[model samples]
Target: MKSTRDTHRFSATTSRFLLPTFRRPCYLDIIKTNVPKSLNKSNIFHKWTEEGQAPYYTIINDALLSDNYNILNQNMIYINNLREAIKENLHQDSIKVYRNLKFCSTYVKDEYKEGMTFLWPTFSSTSRNKDVASTFGNYTFEINASTNDFTYRTDISMYSKYSYEQEVLFYPYSGFRVKKIIPDARIIQLECVDTIEVESNSRILVPEQVKIFDAERKMFVYFYKDNEDLHWSHADTPDQMYLIGQNMNGYWDSHYRYHHSNGYFVHKGNNLWEEYQNEQFHASFQQI
Candidate 1:
């Protein structure tokens, strides 16, 4: 079997801190000094005070590493909140939420040979509830972990960028299909997408040009292709490789998208952003 050494188990050493802490530091002095303009223009200073005086802090110790106060795995709080919500609705404490507990990142190959980092969601639920797999016929909940709102922290710089040609990383993808789309003039300009996946029977139709475009959205798109074959095919490996692409629509003035390839991508930016991104991307190796 073809094996991909992409998916990695997260070790404690993989991260320094979460993105929020980096963007909006938890320290009061740091926030006040660095973002003085924000404080002066808005009620941020007052909000900081409110945070300091939040009712829970008086009753619960926020700094402790106990179950009640997990400084490390902040995602646990989201999990616990979900558990409580489920318990309240179902009225069953037996419904349990569990996780691998260890932090693991999946990597993939991208335009930049260096891998990108995608933080895996460690939460899973167990219940006396009916088996969804048996009833639904083995359906899977694929978290579009590539999207920014997934709430998992991603560290893209975990690996340095390299060349795709020089690096010979093997991935366990069953194969990929190249699609040539000719969209309506009114719709967005997404003409071609190369889907590298484990299982796909989708067909590819050649376009008039080596590159296809939608005159409507005014964008340039290309999919990965092998030199010899019209399609890229590979045998399934023990460890599967998943590709992630992030569309950073509005990070910069030029209309472009930022692409991050891991098991998935971790995107940043709000809903209204548009194209042209001075892209900084890397690949990741993942198992699934």
Candidate 2:
């Protein structure tokens, strides 16, 4: 729900789709017109919203992935409604989900590397049944996920038109660490992991020049600025106080540090720096 602007201009195609209809109102039309004004103020009517084969989901998901803040703002209302609905119906325990995707051979080879972290920036749909997932494609993703305060996911099968699919929805910007890859079986195992805290009106701030020495690698890791701040840091820390820089792999490797008592910027314990360091140190060893 974090956005820079209040107003948004939709694409021509999306604008046309969102127009009110007088003859027979579609789901979105009803939402734009008939949904009570009081409910809009209260922001409580979203609980009644269903996730069936509505065209709005496509728009919402697309907007979530877009770089344009205006596009996302345009769909903010729908997105908030869906998020509230999902939160209201979230499962109490951990669950496993599956998704199948068809990728170009080159893309799979380049992007699905083992030990890499994959982020779903848009609302993603998965299935509770592995069989249903397999029917979609040959490349299967086996995800272990849970619902918690930081992690947002829900079993939306009850609200979906295709209830038999047993759909599980992961909210936008969910992070998953790739654990294993079985090339023969075309299965990729992933575990849900928390990355960075996302806040509204926040943008990445990078230092002009900063480099860290990797004693293990025997080389210096260079840093570059990013347009957006996706890496997680302490919520209490002011946005301007935190900085993010990408390493050679285009991954966030900058340390989230605070001023120490000794007048040094020291990395915070139990944060992204710890995970990155651990991963880097262990990456050189081959699994026997």
Candidate 3:
């Protein structure tokens, strides 16, 4: 009985400091009996705490509450440090990629006032969202033989420059095909292109002389074979992704295209781009 009375007395003395919120199931139960009957249970205090103040027999000690507060603060600090470390690791990996790869550039020899320069976007595992894949993947190249020779194991494969369409060739694709480009009779010459990827069961009838015109709107992607009256099949439009060519079967009867191999091309052939590209390219940085 004495101990109960003493706890009640302790709460009564601290009544003025405690605010009302005793009605709810809270720590206020600890001092409920000590509260004066005249005090309302729903009042707010001058300050706020995790637990609202309430009158009870045993007042919650401030010292014990402070120990818990210190522990919570330390946990928050630990979480912040962990998050920062993860970001730093990501940044370091990005830097390492830049230092390793040797970067090269490409561009046109002359200036163009009005033309849409197209390029296939390369996949960057870091910069792009990992869940999404890059739709535009394959790209064609002029393959400047002297400077960009694929003879070396590390060199990139040289393809046609007019990479407007995805041409489809026949089964003998393992065999090479002969292709050439010629400038049309005009004041301004047309932009050059190349054949990158060919689909199966399609044949492009090559013409005697490659024709050139102002292909501003990304028109047909065809190749000239020889003096033959027939022209090789070609894609309808540059914007169209799929190129379908027909199988060539005619007088030559060789099945092999022209005097050349089916489609096997040496890097050092034709009026390919030779001038050094003076443009700057960021090979390492991410799109982000």
Best by TM-score: 2
Better-scoring candidate (lDDT), 2 or 3: 2
TM values, all candidates: 0.16, 0.52, 0.14
| Runs with alpha carbons beyond 4 Å of true place in candidate 1 | 1-123, 130-212, 217-219, 225-288
C-alpha root-mean-square deviation, each candidate? 23.1, 15.5, 35.4
Q: Which tens-of-lDDT digit does each residue in 160-245 have in candidate 2?
A: 44556676777655667678988878888988865353221011432433334334444332233342322222323323233344
Give model 3's TM-score versus the native structure.
0.14
Per-residue lDDT of 1-288 in model 1, one digit per residue for the tens? 111222111111112121110111122122132211221211211211122234222122222111122342333343234223323332211121111112222211111111112111121211111221112211111111122221212121112131111111101110111122122211111111112211121112211212222234433233222211111112333123232234221111001122112111222233222222223333221111
Summarize candidate 3's per-residue lDDT along 128-215 as a digit string, tens digits: 1111111121111111112221111110001212112111111000111212211131111112112122111122322244332222
Candidate 1 vs candidate 2: the lDDT winner is 2
- Positional deviation of residue 196's Cα in model 1 after best superposition, in angstroms: 14
lDDT of each: 0.20, 0.46, 0.19
TM-score of 1: 0.16
